[model samples]
Target: MSAIDNLPPLREVIATHQLSARKSLGQNFLLDLNLTAKIARQAGDLAACDVLEIGPGPGGLTRGLLSEGARKVVAIEKDTRCIAALQDIAAAYPGRLQIINGDALEIDPLQHLTPPVRIAANLPYNVGTELLVRWLTPPDWPPFWQSLTLMFQREVAERIVAQPGGKAYGRLAILAQWRCEARIAMSLPPEAFTPPPKVSSAVVHLTALPEPRYPADAATLSRVVAAAFNQRRKMLRASLKGMAPDIEDRLIAAGIKPTDRAEQISLEGFCALARELRRP
Candidate 1:
């Protein structure tokens, strides 16, 4: 039995189910029940929160969330081969676990979840960033979930919490930091996975703030950030010229120098410029 549950250890479960990590689906299963439980703890007080987990190969983290006292866990896995394995977990935990065999990108998890929801996943690498973007860019100020604790390549995790003036500081940093308190909560070596990925991984914990740190139209700010970082090497005056005819004046009015590059500008600077551009 695994340390966290009566179910067999993950390797045994994988062997019985004939499950192998599929590169096309970006699967790298984490097999250590103890480690998986540790990752779940980073989400903070899951006792009352319903959790949404993605790509739970062999149900390593699924068991973790349940054992860690999550009120309920709704797991979405695209791999049909792993359905039976996850079903084993559902049986073990009874109603505490819900397994959905579908592509996470296509399905809306909100229907299955109650409020006070938190998302925790050892996400499939192929769709991780896309999923994070979707969560961060919802139309409303306060999103459906209370928090997101997710695993990503170390490089990608750095991008989410990166400060201005670094190469990693780009659209993602602006988007996440504008309305959430983001930090890298844990790190794992490549060797931690069943079939280790070449790069290291880290878990990012983000708790949503009631409102954005600075007031700016979300669409306008997104456009401004995208344009600035799309050609990050170019000076603001050159890259953002397409945005407005007098873009240099707008930059100065926003308290930014015309020659400054995107990497040098803080999130507040971008929001300020976005407000200026929104002006008639």
Candidate 2:
């Protein structure tokens, strides 16, 4: 069956399966087949990788990925009603789609997929940041997945690719930029999604670094970033007050201006500060 012919329109499938968007699950189904197809292409060549797609409500992106020549796709859907709809895609593709019914957070995509894995998803709004942080801060070096082609609220996307001293620059920017080469590939207005999310959305493509930009522990780095940005309105010396009395000294030692606000510092500067804090 052709990509268009094989899967029913997402709306019909959702209704037939009685799949209503559950707010608690962060569900906002993507109904436009053409839009999903465009997103699938953004992942580059899916023919070479096992695609990891999270929250594929109604399987719109799933169908697109399969049609785009995916070697295989492991779709993790938390909604049971959506699972049956995805089962149809699995049957249509035969061996190319595997629908796992659970949260993507609990399942490690790398363990389930081999090398050359790439995550392509119209992620659930709430967990998108959490999931991206997990991928960007994998405990092991030379992290899994060749790249990530994932969607986020436009504001969130700004945070991912936001530059030093930019208004959007903060913890997310630091963590994402520190470990990956990132760029915002495309943007979508609120109308792009079914039921239309209040905010616009954007797709971000992040390829992992060979190693993080600096020598530091991911956990410690995240903590330092979080503390510094939690009170971004203040200078680093004041914002990181809860961390230690020497926080100002450490910031200066790391070559970051002690008086600079969190948004003013670069990702490398954050890493350098984390290293300083990591020492006894």
Candidate 2 lDDT, tens digit per residue, 120-210?
A: 9999998999998888877797877888999999999998989987788888888888878899998998887777888889999998888
Instruction: Report, for every candidate in turn, its global Cα lDDT versus the true structure.
Output: 0.95, 0.85
TM-score per candidate, chains pooled: 0.99, 0.92
Tell me the TM-score of model 2.
Answer: 0.92
Model 1 worst lDDT run, 10 consecutive residues: 1-10
Best by lDDT: 1
Every candidate's CA RMSD: 0.6, 2.0
Candidate 1, residues 1-280, lDDT tens digits: the string is 7788788999899999999999999999999999999999999999888999999888999999999999999999999999999998898888999999999999999999998999999999999999999999999979999999999999999999999989999999999999999999999999999799999999999999999999999999999999999999999999999999999999999999999999999999999999999998
The positional error of residue 67 in candidate 1, measured at the CA in angstroms, is 0.1
